[model samples]
Target: MQRMAAIDPIAYGANRNHYDGAVTRLSPYLRHGVLSLKEVSEHVIALVPTPRSADKLLQELAWRDYYRRVLGERGDAVREDLEPYKTGYQPSDYADALPADFLAAQTGNDFVDATVRELHETGYLHNQGRMKIAAYVVHWRRVKWQAGAAWMYAHLLDGDLASNHLSWQWVASTFAAKPYLFNLDNLLRWTGGRFTGCDADGRSPFDASYDELNRRLFA
Candidate 1:
């Protein structure tokens, strides 16, 4: 709790996307009821003199609250897609279980495999990493979002039904207009080359432009 309380919200807002960003690793505490969203927000507000400095961090807290609101209203329906998938593929088309390669962290994509390994080892993943893996599983591996959600919940110490499942649905295009997809360039830009495309030819599955990705994955 002291560690979370000491986080600099201003720095968090500035550097939260880089591989080594100033994210306050507070979700596990929040998820397990050791901290409350309102308390966290208030603490950030007190530490940061300007409201704008805390806006981004507070916005994240608001997202968590939004998920809780969704869970409250929808109840067990949160286990399923909140809307029809925009992609033409039916729910039945997706695999019932995550593939062996994915579960084993052997997707042959170094960035993805490493993230999965980190999640398994540390029970935590960077938010950006989570989104990328979720997108890869849903759009690239053709696994059902529910399966991926369950896999994540099984490993994540901070896993909450509202945040975990809803975020998966958001990436799967069942809650958003289009599925989230990231390219090799975006990955390199964010990770400072800590992770790279897996193919020796420098053409991994995510090497395409966003337009190409949308066409290939959704068309």
Candidate 2:
């Protein structure tokens, strides 16, 4: 039997959301034995009232349970070089072009820099920002997914090895049929111009040059 120490209930409350303002103050309780997952799910059901919201909360909790199971099943294989679809794969001659400046928010591209800074400072990033950042690292910078996964594991406060590692591989096209990339215009709109892919008036970096940022990054 595994003995565990008590944790605060507040940590779980805060981490319900996966963003900057997440109130993950109740997670510790759920993580340890301070509170039970069944109790938490029931309590949320009671408070939410509406079936939709209650179901959503329940689903999220279930996902945590699923991840826990997967971790137990994979164990060492989680990080092992098990290229599922490869025929004769060997870890050799990887081409990684990740830039230190980019990871440090010194890339000079406001959109990319701001996203990295947000993740670094708050230990979280909005879902859109997550996609964009991943796209930038893989499509724009041409870095290996393993490298990017390592960087995220070192930063994100709520980082899960199962989710983070696999998601990185999916975005980089190693685990997916094609690479995941998003247009620069959508990136600007999602962050509400905070990162500003263009100008103050919603102009894109490609407006003058037919939006060649995509070609420059992906090419």
Candidate 3:
């Protein structure tokens, strides 16, 4: 309740339409051991029988296991910079790259501002939104992946260490060696303009057509 002020059905696990990212329901079950992997998988497989939704959901659970294993093996290296020797790479100071107002949803980039606003007010940003935000933070702002990942960890109630830390590394190009960048057109499409640049001054454009955005995004 403290992490995210409200629940977003769009980011919930029960919502089959949104099975991509943080679903904010596993924390309690994980705490109580009520939703063990075997039990949840058996229940899901039994219900749908050849269900892709079930498959996707199960894969996420597996991801949890994978992260735990990686943490076990690497330990301290998981969060610390892994670049070898001082000669290989220079540590990035991303503080200058990020605009204080922007990360706080104060910057006037209509698209990203809307995104930050949603994340701030609801404590939930969709999977695609997460990628976009990371791209902006790392590629655009040149901030360290660790910084953004830590911020997400602080706020997201369902934040998983493996998913959060490794995924941030992926976005920062530490793992992939290339930060992903999305255009405004693609952003509009993926999010269906649900949260987009509102106006020229970052006020709320809200002028979006779901069908059109989907068509463009898929095309």
Candidate 4:
């Protein structure tokens, strides 16, 4: 209740994607049924002068409900791919487990190494952190989405079958309209310069443009 009361929907909608954004941090409660989407939506809607002012925050809450509905409809299949890899690779081609470099937090990318350390130490990653790390694992490392999802699920405090697995599918282009990708500029922008998006060698695979990334990542 106290956390719910402290939510600032306007701030959340405006800046939720940054590394140090005003995220509500209510997922563990919401995931465990301590709070419902309806309740949170109602609280947020009441705070904003107009409903549109809270659309971003409300839309995110609705996503939780959407994932749950998909889970109910699909059952165990959510653990598997809902669609083919839009990245031009077959399911069998991807690795079955995370590579040792990632587990050791030595992925050669400073941003990713920091993200891995944060995930292990805190068990809670921001939405951007989750998406990018999953991107690194599934897309960059060419590992299977299930491998990355299971790795994260084992450590997340807010992990849920619907939310976690579905999200991994999205990043891997098995659920989303396109494969999610990011470059050095994206990391520098969202992270407030916290990570250089480069390794100690001062070079990065993510230093390329999106067109180049697509060409490199796909077949």
TM-score of each: 0.96, 0.64, 0.68, 0.97
TM match of model 4 to true structure: 0.97
Instruction: After superposing candidate 1 on the true structure, give the runs of residues whose Cα lies further than 4 Å from its correct spot.
Output: 200-202
Query: Residue 49 in candidate 2 has what lDDT?
Result: 43
Model 2, 184-218: lDDT tens digits are: 55654445556556434555443323246445544
Q: Candidate 4: where are CA atoms >4 Å away? A: none
Q: Which tens-of-lDDT digit does each residue in 100-173 have in candidate 3?
A: 87777766676667777777677666777778787667655656778788877766755767677877777665
User: Cα RMSD (Å) per model?
Assistant: 1.2, 7.2, 7.8, 0.9
Give the per-residue lDDT digits (tens) of candidate 4, residues 1-219.
Answer: 889988999899889999888899999999889998888899999999999999999999989999999999999999999998999899998999999999999877898899999989998999988999999898888999999999899899898999999999999999988899988888788899898888879998789999999999888
The numbered model that scores best in TM-score is 4
State which candidate has the highest lDDT: 4
Predictions in order: lDDT: 0.88, 0.58, 0.60, 0.91
Candidate achieving higher TM-score, 1 or 3: 1
Which pairs of residues collide in candidate 3?
A: 94-143, 110-197, 111-197, 198-204, 198-205
In order, how many clashes per candidate? 0, 16, 5, 0
